[model samples]
Target: MKKTINWKFTLILLTVGFMTAVQYNSMKNPKERDTRDIWAVRHELAVEKQLHSELLSEIRELDKTIFTYKSLNDENTGKALTETVDKLYSQAGMTNIQGTGIIIKVKPSAESEAFGIPVTDVSPDLLTRFVNEINRFKGLILEIDGKRFTTLSSIRDINGITTVNGLNVSTPPVSMKIISPSFKDSEKLYSYLAASTIHDDFYIDNLILEVGKPERFVEIHGSPEMFENQFLKELPKGE
Candidate 1:
């Protein structure tokens, strides 16, 4: 019992310390932007929105855990701590998810194929914008080309090839799986994505965005990489 209590307390302290470091960094290093194009500004806004949403979600989760810890008896403390840890892992994209959601397929447009026009690679900017829009509805777990999309994941172009989570996905016929909180939400997301202008955005690039119908069973794999506190060091002990 003593060991269990010590472990849980240590875990909570470590989590709090990490979050404090993140908060300090955010306060210390504010983002600066120069005169840029509309697309750049839009992308920045989207990224900010996504970060804000994630922070709020995590805050809620932590608050719930704190309440649980305060009220939990010794008999149930272990079980509650285990459940909280599992939930945190799932939210961090460390666990595969099977739930209600939809699949989206991206490929070359028929017109491009028929006209023999070379299909361009997926634009990293455009893909990021689309992800931002998808996040607006919330309750989403996304995976692209079998790579899970986590908060730390990066979608960028290296030598003209787009990569998500450091894996190449610039080619056509890319598959994206999204797991939603419920079937109803998945259906709504399908309808929303189907009507989104992102489809037109892809069409302009000779690519197609096909949003699939809602499914009760959708699989989203976990992220392969783990989050690390690369920059943070242990704080000096209090006097």
Candidate 2:
């Protein structure tokens, strides 16, 4: 019993000392630590939104051109043209199908504030895991903070600010919209994430994930820039 008590006492000292050293290091390099300017991040996001609008304008022009081509084409060519249009819309996220889906909102937990943990921002790693998990469950469409998710979507520390597809999602209580192919898939996602406290330890310990009820007729917009930015031509068959 005496030996066990000594071991516990020594472990406590080592743990306290390690935490104190960490605190000292943080104080030594305060600027090197968390110091992202929210204003700059917001301005950059506005620029991105303007860019998306420009791309949307160009897509509208192309749609008009395609419509004219369809009008003059033979029946088979017209069918192919229609198919191409549908494919582009699907990739661009303009599909207006009625579907059941879920919205997940994340915020810093009360525990984090109580313990003085700086977790007001949702880190890029946590966002990435959320995206990957939703995709794994066959998520048909996704959006973060009103910014559509595409093949080019990414969550990263941009200019010291965590951003999702050029928009700052670092702010707490950001919502992630998940549109599943079916109602069942939406439920699966909720169950998986709900039961994954251990897996999402970093997020759960520092933040709160609020899962919402599945709803129908949820709308998801696709990125117009997805097609506007694509120019690589496919090689002809057997060329």
Candidate 3:
């Protein structure tokens, strides 16, 4: 009878051990699966964030490039660039414009009475004296009739053969344009020239005067300090 009891007890103990082992294994499987699922979600989120950061960086770079290109293509920007270039050119002593100013045109007097001499036959010295007088008033010559003047402007003989500088350009029935900074100075100059003996036989007329506008061509070269300040202050940081 004792042997029979011992056998029954052993069987019961074995059954309890087997059931505990199975239950523990089942719970562990589910916990392990949950851990793996969490890991996968975190990994996917990391990848998505990395991709988003890369896309954002690319977008920022593209914006900068587009802005730069559009600024260069704009007309106002072009004008500014041209003006900057002109300033540099002036500093280099390669420009023709001396200063900001206006252009004034003067026409010769028309005569109804014939002086028995053709207008073209008039002495070239008269024209030379007139040009000299205007220059004395600090006038910069632009044109005489169709002739264009430059930094090295000069007068030539009516025969169009000889060149003269610092003298009245010898020509008949002269038409000329002058560039000056002051309208008052230009008017005074006209008054002086008209009252002088040079225009005694000719009528003096003011044709047109053109003033400089605020808009001008400019070109900026090299990285300026202002750009450095702007760049440093506006630089983007990483995500």
TM of each candidate vs. truth = 0.70, 0.58, 0.34
Worst 10 residues of 1 by lDDT: 26-35
Models sorted by lDDT, best on top: 1, 2, 3
- The candidate, 1 or 3, that scores higher on lDDT is 1
Looking at candidate 1, what is the lDDT of residue 144?
A: 85
Global local distance difference test of model 2:
0.73
Off by over 4 Å in 3: 1-116, 121-123, 158-174, 201-239
Off by over 4 Å in 1: 1-58, 73-76, 228-239
Per-residue lDDT of 157-239 in model 1, one digit per residue for the tens?
98889999778984888899999989999988988998888999899899999998999898887887777778989788883
lDDT of 2 by residue, 1-239 (tens): 99999999999999999999999988887865545599988977877886797689879978976776767647667666787789778766666444778887877787788888876576677677767666545436887887788766778898778886677764777787788888888788778777865346545647778888777757766554544547778799889
lDDT of 2 at 173: 72
Question: Mind giving the per-residue lDDT tens digits that candidate 3 earns over 1-239?
Answer: 99999999999999999999999999877755444687899988887886797689869966875576577855677676576667545433244443322333333333422344333322345445555656555434344454444444556663444344433443343444454556566556556654665545334321112222211221222211111234445347773
What lDDT is obtained when candidate 3 is compared to the true structure? 0.49
C-alpha lDDT values of all predictions:
0.88, 0.73, 0.49
